[model samples]
Target: MVVFGKELYKIKSDRYKKARGGWSRIIKLHCVECGEYLFDYQKDGAGILKRLYFDRIFKELPKKPLKCKCGQLLGIPIIYKKEERPAIRLFSGVVKK
Candidate 1:
């Protein structure tokens, strides 16, 4: 696990390629309420992060409703209907890039 700031993240080393836009950047997700580091994410396209794919998360996360250490609600675990992939639906203004 790679330590960043005060948090530990298990970096994902496997490379993933998309038919469309490839992996763009790796961004550190932070808690909005406390500004604490949440996790590292491999974001594909630009713009707001509405959902976080499980495979893109670089750290192990708790099951079900994912929350920050400060108890602030971040996202809910769900299967994205369109892609049929497991992902976390992030709440608005709960997290920052």
Candidate 2:
């Protein structure tokens, strides 16, 4: 299936499985600069996407400093202190949901 102008790949996510009690949605992530498909992500809750946890990612990505094929620096990997987990801190306005 295709969604958001990209092919969709449905994958099960265990991130926050217990905490959210299955309250999550899979979203198609794209690069704002070139409109390139980044990856399919499992997102929780509702609001602007601040960051992406490593475990919630459906596709494997390069280590740290995530970038799109168009050369846009999308995000940088960091340890989310509040959640005490590994995550990618997204650059504001660099990505499209």
Candidate 3:
């Protein structure tokens, strides 16, 4: 759930190892509104909505309204609004349990 963009934000880089290559960058974009996870791994870039961007196709997403196929309306609910942190962080040692 680590949302990355302008800051070179680090999630579990150890977890996202195969997330390499130009335009082949794999990412899991979480929807704050629908509570779903989307991917940027497919070769077909248009498979997911660009408004969701995944930090690749679009620079920002707060203004974008998402229409999930499941009929959930969501988007980058935290972007352009506040500095929100991921609900969970792995290996970075935020876990206390």
- Give the alpha carbon lDDT tens digit for every residue of 33-97 in model 2: 99997888878766789889888788787667998888889889988997798999999999887
Judging by TM-score against the true structure, name the best candidate.
2
lDDT tens digits, residues 1-97, model 3? Answer: 3344433433323322343332333354454445555433222232333322233322333334444455555433333223232111112211111
Q: How many backbone clashes does candidate 2 have?
A: 0
Q: What is the C-alpha lDDT of each candidate?
A: 0.79, 0.79, 0.33
Estimate, for each residue in 1-97, the C-alpha lDDT of model 1 and write its tens digit.
6566666656554433353255456788899899998888877655688989898887777658998899998889999997788999999999887
TM-score of each: 0.78, 0.79, 0.24
Q: What is the overall TM-score of model 3 with all chains considered together?
A: 0.24
Q: Candidate 2 — which residues are off by over 4 angstroms?
A: 1-22
**Which wins on lDDT, candidate 1 or candidate 3?**
1
Model 2 lDDT-worst window of ten: 1-10
CA-only RMSD, every prediction: 3.8, 3.4, 13.5
